[model samples]
Target: GGGSSSGGGGSSSGGGASAPAPGPQQPSRPAPGPAPAPAPAPAPAPSGNAAQVAISFAKAQLGESYILGGAGPNVWDCSGLVMMAYGAAGIDVGSHSVSSQYNTMQARGRLVPFSQRQAGDIIFWNDGSGFYHDAISLGGNTIIAAPKPGDVVKIQGLWGGSDIMPYVGRPG
Candidate 1:
């Protein structure tokens, strides 16, 4: 009878041993502490200004080829580049056409005088009959554009002439 009682006591201790197994795993959970470090990395992107975020996205595409209607991960057109840049910042300018983008900005009351333009403003151009080209302003007199077919996206001095629209679109 004493041997039977001892056997029962040994079984109870086996259950106690299982509890310690989770104790060892508690230390492994601390390894996930470093995982939170990466969480803060994505925080800055959200806190940064939208215009700056769009500018950064456009700058990354410099040297990519230009296609007449491309809106892409590689090639882009004038309005397409402007569209995707602001799209990266979570602002939708609508359509891949310069005229449509200008109208969208106007409808949203985002049009500002060209003299008040700042970085990330969408600058449109009217060659003669209608709004035809667009680009993202880099502040001052520089702009990033995917000018015409066969050319690559590049930052160049802002074009000044009768063709430039009087106002620039400031998408939030």
Candidate 2:
């Protein structure tokens, strides 16, 4: 005999029908448990040392006179300043020509995204055909360079917006 199944109550004998072979038993489920804790967040990547050294070296040259192609101790041109800074950091960035520097960076270094450039990365400006100017990043949107013949090596805000600095290269 079988009766309609009742919740939590065993089948009851009623109209003389054999209770459907007791259906397969289900294992008991544990009572509700607490939710699992979330996973920890990932850590940031380690920035390297050469970049900081390059920035420091560049800053120390501030107030030095600008010359057409000056490269060192007392005077500097745009690309010259950048080259010497990277040299101080122990990276050879090739010669003091803007075009040469651009080629070196493109071949050996990486083209950093315009928004992602950091201190010590080399910045290049294009003069229609190819790169014609460069500077050393001083972080915080500032740079140090020998801007022009009459200007001294100095710290200046990034000028001409992002279009001017079409390329940023990391020398590592």
Candidate 3:
């Protein structure tokens, strides 16, 4: 009688556990219905050659001097270079501020994980305090940037360390 009771107890417990699992799952299914509503907002896909257009524009500025707020035919700052580059491809990144550029891309769902960056993607840098700099990716591990004052826009290796943001803007 004791052996039969032990088997019955185990079966009841198993049944009770499975019953709760299905109960929780039913409630979870309805939650996903509303979750997908925001999906359409990010549906705008990148234009086929937009990345190449942006990258070419940035690369063409290789020898341009860096100016604090220059958006330029000549001088450029970090964000200025990025803004102008995307603008060339018909994408307006809102402002010339690095942080704002990042936010705009994020809000528009045009940001890509840093690990998945592609040519013309804008990479931002955080100098502990906040986002301070940005550059345009040239695919692989390279980027083109205006650098600092007195420096010209040039192609360089992608920066690493804690300063690099986790995502890069894909304005195309």
The candidate that wins on TM-score is: 3
Task: Report, for every candidate in turn, its global Cα lDDT versus the true structure.
Answer: 0.83, 0.77, 0.83
Candidate 1 — which residues are off by over 4 angstroms? Answer: 1-48
**Per the 3 Å backbone cut-off, how many clashing residue pairs does candidate 2 have?**
1
Error in Å for residue 21 of model 2: 94
**Backbone clash numbers for all candidates listed:** 0, 1, 0
Model 1 lDDT, residue 120, Cα: 79
Query: What are the runs in model 3 whose C-alpha is more than 4 Å off?
Result: 1-47
Candidate that beats the other on TM-score, 1 or 3, i.e. the better one: 3
Residue range 1-172, candidate 3, lDDT tens digits? 4554334645334355533455444543455345544435444354458778888998889898999999999999999988888889888886989999999988888877888887778889998888899998888789999999889999999776789998888885
| Predicted structure 2: lDDT | 0.77
**Prediction 1 global C-alpha lDDT:** 0.83
TM-score of each: 0.71, 0.68, 0.72
Give the alpha carbon lDDT tens digit for every residue of 1-172 in model 1.
Answer: 4554333545344354534455345533455445543332121122238789888998999999998889989999999998898889888997889999999988877788899888878889998789889998889999999998999999999875889999988886
Clashing pairs in 1: none
Selected candidate, larger lDDT, 2 vs 3: 3
